[model samples]
Target: MLRSTIGGLLIAFLAFGTAAAQTYRPAFDPGALKGPRAGAPNMVMVLGTPHLSSFPESFDPDRLGGLLERLEAWGPQAIAIESLSGPQCDFMRRYPERYRDTVEDYCWDPAPARAATGLEVPAATAEAKRLLASWPEEPTPSQRRRLAAVFLAGGEQASALVQWLRLPETERQVGNGLDDVLVARLETLEGRRNENTLIAAPLAARLGHERVYAMDDHTADAAVSDKEAYGKAIMAAWDNPAVAKRKALDDALADEIGTDEGVLVLYRAYNRPVLAQLAFEGDFGAALEEPSPQRFGRRYLGYWETRNLRMAANIREMLGFNPGMRALVIVGASHKGYLEAYLDQMHDVHLVDTDTVLH
Candidate 1:
């Protein structure tokens, strides 16, 4: 009688347990993705790429063809590029005097382009809106030649491209009426001197897209405090040993860039989340976390985060214009993790699996 009673209790407990299991709810629900602003959640995928000029001389293009094809095949509704454009470019153009010192020291040469456009930097800068607004839908081949010339002259390549694609397809030929200087420049770009020319614009053109989003943020780039002091503080506080080790790894990777397979390997590693975290660590890890008088590390981290936050916001706004969109962001590898972290916070945003795309 005791054994039978115990068996009955066990059976009852099992039945109750089975019922509870059947009623359990899962953590994920498709309904959670749909928000008030969007009919369905939008997906974001951030791809980290090496800066175009950062690659070694022996870098191969053949290997990247497959990668490019896959990305194009994925057919994202929108693609965000890392170039300084949209409002940031407007700010730079409006107050060249304020930003010129830094920009000229590092990147961009508007001289050749300005000279070719027959307008001074400030004059050409002022005309961007007018030109883009009135740009041709099907530009003559000579017009494309002229735009290519402008590119050689150092005109804003992104804006120039915006104007170029409006023209007819046949009018966009590079060699037509273009001198060797312009032709050479076109060849250099086709060979992938910069990601704008090498990948972003061309891929967009292939996909029949009209414009690419310029998502870079430079608002927090200016250092407010004693710049020299901040610099010194960071170098002193940072883990120099880690920096040296990363440099060694970078050097090793640089050596492998010559072959197509090697380039993909390098890029895949670059796009990894671990790599982005490592980048964050190198950029401000020790300085911000350690005890210090200057605390420049924290300040630096603050600026970086601010810039990334704004960038992510810009992307979100872009998505707001279209419902249920999938956007692909191509940015410098360092920005990948930050962008992803911030973008993931949006209520209706979904981050696509980068691992699947990359692998």
Candidate 2:
């Protein structure tokens, strides 16, 4: 009887240990799983958080709550946001001093009554006003200085800082010609407030205004034409040896994976001479050639690759030395698809199911 009881206790101890081991797995690991290197940082918590379009009025709060809970439970040391590189972020970092009131004051706030009794504006306008009213007061000087260092550093370094600031209210009233057009579009969009992207704002806001890092390269301007030209150049460089080498490396890893599970490669769809010259002729090498947009889609795609690689490198550099760090990247969905493919082939990343997260 004594021997039997001891054996039972041992079995229970082993079972409990196994369960605890499973529960304690790190969210990200940069090591291997089967061979000698198995269990390094081989695991990465690559979640695809939604952008403005991912929210809808009918969005499942439970689903979103679950997602956020899981992420927090995963205890990711860092979160990456999509808008960290924008002017909006810059303004937030230097509010009331370098700039005026928060973006919410300019964009989300409703225009004050013009004559004490014009018909009350649309509900969308009213909502925008409410949002502006909610913005926190401007940052302190020390905060501004800290944010300046972040913005100056550029890349994920800046992102880490921007993520900590609160999101400005959506712009509603327009003060200028550009503002007028932008406001009109925003109002039109707001009427259909049932979209998931808009609904997700609260979730993003809840993720602590500062815990999320922006995951984009700050150098790229939104100028459409310039981007188009740059895209062309990248496409042209596809034939260069260095480009061949990068592609080969990506392909070799894909081959080894046996399953196209974790890599994303972005290729340019347009080629511009100036951009081509800059990417290929500059430090990046001849592989960065400009391709013809006329032949592709008349839109710049190569810029995506250049931007993504720079961002990825920054992220690696920022957190590579930190022990037990997990990262989630949010970006344009089109880019997400390509990036996922390329990242799958990387050394220590496991692509989480983006589609699952989206729903």
lDDT of 2 by residue, 196-290 (tens): 22222333335543334445553432344455555566456555655555446434533322221211111111111222333333324443223
lDDT of 1 by residue, 1-359 (tens): 99999999999999999999999988876535546562666888888888877665556555567567767877888888877653355456566656665455434555445544565544554554344467577655665566545443434555355435444655545443345544444445555566676677777776766567877777666635587777777777666666666677678888767666676677777877677767766766765675557667887788778989988988988898886887888888888888887887677788886667756
Scored by lDDT, model 2 comes in at 0.40
Q: Where in model 2 is the C-alpha error above 4 Å?
A: 1-39, 53-63, 85-210, 222-299, 354-359
Q: How accurate is candidate 1 locally (lDDT)?
A: 0.67
**Structural similarity to truth (TM-score) of each candidate:** 0.71, 0.37
Report each candidate's C-alpha RMSD, comma-separated, in the order given: 12.4, 21.2
Best by TM-score: 1
For residue 204, model 1's alpha carbon misses the true position, in angstroms, by 1.3
Model 2 poorest ten-residue lDDT run: 263-272
lDDT score, residue 59, model 2? 34
- TM-score of predicted structure 1: 0.71
Per-residue error at 144 for model 2, in Å? 14
